[model samples]
Target: MDVIVSRSGGLAGLWVTWHVHVDEQPDRDDWYLLIRELPWEEPLPVPPEPDRYTYRIRCEPHEATLAERQLTGPWRTLVDRVQERSEPERGRPANGSDRTRPPSSRRPRRGC
Candidate 1:
């Protein structure tokens, strides 16, 4: 299974994404356990507060969006683990550069 987590709407208003392939993880079983315990069917919380981060999580067919204030317990655990173990999504580096791709392969700009 594949897991994706994205955080947006923080003070910087930047979108940061992380992705993990569960089958590639050494602790896949532990991830499965945490995933199974999430309240997927429960209603999502109210709209996020201004300038607060919002998280969107997806594990295959199951997905949820939660405000920063609502991330807790198992949800927090899963997100933290994924962020620690996974790579940044393509073209959405937390910094200004694309960490997934090599610097040599980047195209040069047409104009200065």
Candidate 2:
């Protein structure tokens, strides 16, 4: 299962994104259950704030958004951890950075 989270807007108007591969994660079942438990079928509960952050979550056949104040328990937990993993830790790359991007192709240079 692939979970992609996009967090947009903040004090700085920055947008952050997260992509979590549930299968590769340690608590795959928990993640799956959490995702299923989220209220995806409902419409945006309230009108959005002009500059507040909103989240766009997409995974498999499920997709939804938690905008501004709508960031509740499970959704909050999910995004928090995803962001934590996104921050630079130690001298290495961000935790989930490796799985986020695909490999690029390289061609041989012409003979000089």
Candidate 3:
């Protein structure tokens, strides 16, 4: 399974994207559970704050979607964990490890 999270809609409207191949993730099953816990069938609600960042998470092969309002419970956990791990460290990979990722247009992960 693949897990991708993208954050868009801040004051500047720039998008930040992150993703992980769940099968290679350390806690793969846990991520699967979190994905299951999200309300995939529901359409994302209108953002309460137009400028407040909202996340678009696509797990299970890009089939599900959720809104900021629905980002409670496990949804919150999933987002938080993804955000935390996606932050790259100096000389560290974007996924926070030695494992290499496919090339993309995203800026190189910056070291703290």
Candidate 4:
């Protein structure tokens, strides 16, 4: 299985990170990390149009591993970790209306 996560607000300048693991050697193209940084403007796209400076980490599995039992999952784990480290709750609240454009070609819901 795979997971994805996004983090926004809180610290003035902070970076988001994620780690993913699969049952076996899966196609690299099947999964990836996408980062979209919100610009200082109105009507920001859901994904911020894949900001050139956005932060993301793509997971690559080891070459020799096989018959895997556990997977690293998705960035959600990292986001949860960040939340635990930063605030008392699960990071900041997501205001979807703040965005003007809908989610980009990317899949899944967009949160801020």
Per-candidate local distance difference test: 0.71, 0.60, 0.58, 0.28
**CA RMSD (A), model 3:** 9.6
Question: What residue pairs clash in candidate 1, if any at all?
Answer: none
Per-residue lDDT of candidate 1, residues 4-90 (tens digit): 777776555666778777877899898888889999888466474887877878776787888888899899999999899966653
lDDT of 3 at 61: 39
For all predictions, the C-alpha RMSD in Å is 9.6, 11.0, 9.6, 16.3
lDDT agreement of model 4 with the native: 0.28
The TM-score ranking, best first, is 1, 2, 3, 4
What TM-score would every model get versus the actual structure?
0.76, 0.67, 0.64, 0.21
Error of 1 at 24 (Å): 0.4
Query: Which candidate number maximizes lDDT?
Result: 1
The local lDDT score (0 to 100) that residue 89 gets in candidate 1 is 50
For model 3, the superposed segments whose C-alpha errors exceed 4 Å read: 61-69, 87-112
By summed lDDT, which 10 consecutive residues of candidate 2 come out lowest? 103-112
For candidate 4, write residues 12-90 as lDDT tens digits. Answer: 3232323333222254233322212211122223333232223232222211111111113333343344334332212
Compare candidates 2 and 3 on TM-score and give the better one. 2
For residues 1-112, could you state the per-residue lDDT of candidate 3 as single tens digits? 6566666555655556676666667887887777777766765654456756566666643443444665677767877877766652122234433222322424332111
RMSD of candidate 2 to true structure, Å:
11.0
